[model samples]
Target: MGGNHTQIDFILLGITDSPCLQTPLFVLFLLIYIVTQVGNVGIIILVRVSPSLHTPMYFFLTHFAFTDICYSTVISPRMLADLLSEDKTISFTGCMMQLLTFAFFAISECHLLAMMAYDRHIAICHPLLYVTIISSRVCWQLVASSYLFAFLTAITCTWCTFGGSFCGPNSTDHFCELFPVLKLVCSDTHSSEMLIFAFITFNAVGAIVVIFLSYMSIIHTVLRMCSAQRRARAFHTCASHLMAVSMYFGTGFFMYLQPPSSHRSLDKVASIFYAVLIPMLNPFIYSLRNRVVMGSLVKCGRRIFSCWQHRSFLSSRTRTVHLK
Candidate 1:
């Protein structure tokens, strides 16, 4: 892979080498990236402006959407640039920074999803205490702790991975990722690999366990309800979250849990799904199926139209009076 170089200054990403495929891939991901940004931004705005959605659930969703926006921004723009550029190279520092930022946001998102599941559990299983249990102070603490933990994890992973010798092939099979980057290291990586595997497993399994326990409690409470409508509403409220969680964790687990050589192509596809497609899908997944969000969107649209009409009417009246 390397001729005589002992250390590398730049890493190349071999996403695809086909000349014919470059433009198509660029357009496709460009569109997806645009939709991802707009959709996530819309979710943030919708949650902010809708008083009916000022509940703890939407509060969690707003933060979730924000995280999606952030990580997507970090990864997609660079990938899109590489698709169009002849040399798909990243500086060592750039790659390290990307890894750090991507890991932090992604890990924070996992904790946030777990917290959301717990919020749903409390909301459905103990409705009366939902507000008291998920107060503003409590919500802030949960979010803050998640972020802090993720930051620390990212630092540890980044430090361990970059501390090794990296004299192998500078080209990565897919975009810059933990496993792909780790594979490029020429030094003994057993300790780094073990640390990464443990860290990822701990975070993923912990979040999954929290989600499982919360959902189990929710199901039991839901089963005890006498009213069909209440049960349906509860299930409906959770459906979006379950979908988002599944897509995020399922793809992430599949991508990271295995060795890179066993499924390089498959892992790349999975990475694209979670990094690009999932972010674009999240706002729709959460908002489209939700009656409250739809209602708020409709209401917001009508208010904007009414205000435009009023402004037009006032402008016309003023012009006529001045002319006469």
Candidate 2:
């Protein structure tokens, strides 16, 4: 299979096969992708420029936005192209690369969410030690570790998946997802399937456990607070994160936790939820719910407008001088 494998290309069936649905789906997803990029990139830029957002919380958030951008990019452009193109073909190497990059960012996001939860837990549960616990060095280390672990896991999964022979059909129902691609493998896939299952379960469940415990402690801490103002403040700080985590893990568990034999056509819908919808929603979830981010956005907007006005005035003066 060596020589043949290098030349093989997989046909991705994409979200729908209906001719009528393609244009509308393309428009809808194109808008979503555009918003995903603008929103995530806006968050990154806001955090970078706003000193108020230079805290450990926003630090983690910037990385989270970046991860969303990356994984969303991995899926959306190709999916959009496939919607318009008659040939929905992706090279074998391209498919594997897509899987690897997407897995890396997606797994990184899981860990990043856990880290954000822990940051909130520290902020609310032990406010006195929050600064000490989540210092700059600690934040860097946590972010680095998350990416490192995700990369290792992604590479391992990719290797396991592509190591198997693919002499049979080269078409998959969805994008280059683990299970869908695995279905195309002609070799005995028991070991690969088991390995992928173990890794996915460990990543999802492990992150969820961390988030669960963190929020549980946070709940306990918030309940015991003597001041209602402090309690409301704590909940407000966590609300956006809770929404994001719920949407992410909820869709993730639905997509990956089931048996390969039980994977339905609905899995494609679930994939769209996490891979596309969640990323587009995350920036809004955080920014709209967050007073600090919203304030920063307003300030940035004013600055941009002020600069534009100044440039227009200067240009008008130049025109007047030339007319004279």
Candidate 3:
């Protein structure tokens, strides 16, 4: 019944409330967050610096890694802090902002993965036309469109979910998510819920459909390939992306597709899977099996080592010259 909802703060009852589990949970998430940042950032840096990674595939991959970094940052820090601190209060403005940013990146990533799948399809199916089909301009356009769509969708969802009376409890069982925040609204949320469901379906399910179709074509093409070695290479190239897609889409669908009434404690687990675990795992998923990425990492490491050695040698030479 408050007009100034902005002045109110919502207490986020994070993953666990047990006093004994707090410290251990904090340490676990802290490590996950650290690895998520380091791994995703490493991908971005390698793609930017390595000439071998300057292709359309890597271009999409670089943006995907950046998205993962952003998506994790939106949720992890607050969640990690809440795990340690007794007060898990998030201001209304902060909560809405988090929802907005999180939705934007999350939706963008869904579309980005779809785009990457299309890229792979083109590369595998029509190798010669891959360059012409997915040109630099087209890549930029695809990425921009993904972000634009995500931003508009985020604004709509955030507004629809929060543009109502909030007379209920100021505490949510999970993070500042659509369903949790909606539970606090005093107004009839049927329209907002329907609208959000449509958007989630469009973003998540739609992306899955696109990825599915693309991979189907890719598989058909690979299966028809005359060279067994080429077919093996094609499958290898796709394996990492497919793995990432399965995990991200699986957790996302599990979290969002259920009836709000059916949202159980497992919703939190699903949330953590897509929001925290997926980002941390994406780097390894994409890079570990990727020969190009692995080779680039080695090259980058050597370059860094050589630069450090050169700096040390220069410092020693300067000391000798000063003594002479």
Candidate 4:
């Protein structure tokens, strides 16, 4: 206990002492970061203002936009900072905070994606009962619950994780993460890692199962539809959702479930996918593919332009009045 306490106090508080890699990495990440923020924020605004996209699927798509924004916010800023700095250092508390928030939104995204799958399921499976089954109230509930579940789960996971002592050698090889951080803990982390793994697995794999089943049910129901347009619309609605799910899960599951025995590059590659690429892709996958979103996007763009034009005209009138 004494040694443990001493080690904890001696802990290195910031990011890794590794030298910064600037120029290329910084500029690339900066551009991607800008694009990601713009795209996701754009999606959110478009959906929120568009009456045509106020339905359940678009409602969930709005959450997807939000998830992209949040997920990127959790990781990208620090990454961009580290790229510019000499040491890629993060404080112990800061790292944990990042891990917790990232995992929270990430897990929320897992469930959110599944909830969206369920939304598609209901839409395709029970078109007649879609409104009755997935009412506006229920949609809000799902959204709210995803947030609550994410918060609670992160608290639980962080509690379990931090309960174990990180006794020494806090040089996490890659970035802010649970498993990599856990490995640095000098205490007996076998049980802790196991527990963390179980929770992670449940969130990751369990979501995959639920999403798969929901899609299966949706497919079964959609096949029964006699109308071609009905089938086409159903397929289109679910296609975008499935694509988002696959991208998220494919990168995520590979990252977590891959044997630790695999190459060291594995974690970095996987982290890049979930930590960066996934956020950049999510809004595009969910919104740009949808016709309603495209129409709303155009309308929103025009509205913004008109507002700018109106402001310019008003400013000209004000100048004339002042001159007079």
Candidate 5:
């Protein structure tokens, strides 16, 4: 046992002495994962089933919900596995893949959220011109851009993350990551890290800056409206998006923009924030705040109940007919 313990530590740092608190933490995270999955899936179902929600806004939102689910699933299962593992050393390849996939989702989401904000800005600030501006072709183009950007980011991150040479001791703390993994490499990783940092900052920060600009323009436009009622109405539409955009930018910036000081605890904290929590929260933020989404959910709920009741009635009628 002593020899095995020594080998494990030498191999990589693992949670040999995880406190009893870890059990509850695992349970809590499990519950959060379940709810996040169900909520996002439910939103997707409701949005698809309700014709009223078959518009550009809800369409983007459906994709958003889907992305949230993917985002959560990407990190949570591995996180749960880590809690039970004796050795936390992910394979070099696995680490690069995780970092790539995670970056893809994270970067895509930033752009998507910014695009949604721009959608709302066009809708509210230029009501008459909204249709002409964000037509079906344009909407699909925006969606295409999101996917293409994510694909490019994924390829770029994966290539650069693997660009650094790992001679031995391939152990990364907290989980699979680019920087964390790179830190353990025997080679000088400065150039690779710098390249990745530049790419991510440009993608994430640039999207956020674009969002800020659009919102500022929106604010200017809203201020020009003489009617308090119109301003209030516009505010109502904008608040949910603003809140979501803030959460994405705030948590995202915290994750990427910081200096590469490898703090294992902050890695876990930041990981949970942007990866797990935000995905779970997006469905709520998009649905609860949007009137159309709320309506669609209500309609989906009604249709579900009606189907159940109808089936019950039919079963009861069959019994009565057989008795007669």
Candidate 6:
């Protein structure tokens, strides 16, 4: 909306323009979108209703699940639609909005993961003072701050991204990504690119530093513990979070930090993973290994079955009374 983009009201998204790929891709992405929504929403509900999950860890988890759901919704539905439609176009406004929303959730998740690592650190290293240190107020503050930082990052990046000219190309080779969209600008994007690189670098470095320090401290504390059982449990508690961190950060690091040549083939795939698969898998990663969630699911199942049986019996008795 600034330099040379006045004529461009819509831009094409080249989401696999292959006729052979479109149908299969559409179905695949459709399934993924459904699964992502269901899994993340289930995790949110599980955390909300299960008393065992009402801790600082799960509080952060709930928000993590929520962020995943939101960003996926921002990208996936439109992507799915594009996969089927020949037009494959998104308005300039829609593209910028997607960039902004995606940036917010993506960065928020980075901070949330770091915060979770910190939570784990407190639980393991300073168990005695964990409650006092990470009370409800503190948890709220940490989550709030994570979102606030995300907002600032998104606003800054999005502003810089769209601040320039766009008279070069009206089509993107990939989905509407910050970097790819930057490539389409006719105006000098050096400054905006540098700004984005700086922000991404800083955010990534800051999160990694926090996570690394937290886990390093956790490892030291766990090693000092005498009981094998306690040590095993401590490690078990962190296993899911560590796995999630690795999956998320690994792809993200590769995508953003690597040279453009490396992304020629893997870019879309990596984007799909972070946008679609990771969010879907997070609930399973945390829930399948969790006794609390398993127990809660079982309890809920029993309650539902019992209620159904009661209603059935009531209906039978009413029929018998009426016949008599």
Quick one: best lDDT, which candidate?
2
Model 1 TM-score on a 0 to 1 scale = 0.95
Off by over 4 Å in 1: 1-7
Model 4 misplaced regions, further than 4 Å = 1-21, 259-263, 307-324
Give lDDT per model, in order: 0.87, 0.92, 0.90, 0.76, 0.75, 0.86
Model 6 spans > 4 angstroms off: 5-7, 259-263
TM-score of each: 0.95, 0.94, 0.95, 0.88, 0.90, 0.95
- Tens-place lDDT per residue, model 1, 105-188, is 999999999999999999999889888999999999999999998998899888767777786678775456788787778877
Error of 3 at 116 (Å): 0.4
| Tens digit per residue, CA lDDT, model 2, 1-324 | 122343479999888889999999999999999999999999999999998899999999999999999999999999999999998999989999999999999999999999999999999889899899999999999999999989989998898788877888898865798889888877787888889989989988989999999999999999999999989999999999999999999999988898888999888888988999999999999999999999999999999999999999999999999999
Rank the models by lDDT, top first. Answer: 2, 3, 1, 6, 4, 5
Clash totals for all candidate models: 0, 0, 0, 3, 0, 0
* Residue-wise C-alpha lDDT for candidate 6, range 60-164, written one tens digit per residue: 999999999999898888887777777777778888899899999999999999999999999999999999999999999999999999999999999887888
Better of 2 and 5 by lDDT: 2
- Backbone-clash count (model 5): 0
Q: Is candidate 1 or candidate 6 better by TM-score?
A: 1
- Residue by residue across 1-324, what tens digits does model 3's lDDT show? 224344468999888868899899889999999999999999998999999999999999989999999989999999988887878899889999999999999999999999999999999999999899999999999999999999999999999878888876898865789998888888788888889989888888778888999999999999999999999999999999999888988888887888777888878888988899999999998889999999999999999999999999999999999999
Candidate 5 per-residue C-alpha lDDT over 158-200 given as tens digits, one digit per residue, 9 for 90 to 100:
7766664555665655556666665655556667677778888
Model 6 lDDT at residue 76: 82
* Candidate number that wins on lDDT, 1 or 6: 1
Q: What is model 3's C-alpha RMSD? A: 2.0
Task: For residue 215, give model 3's deviation from the true position in Å.
Answer: 0.7
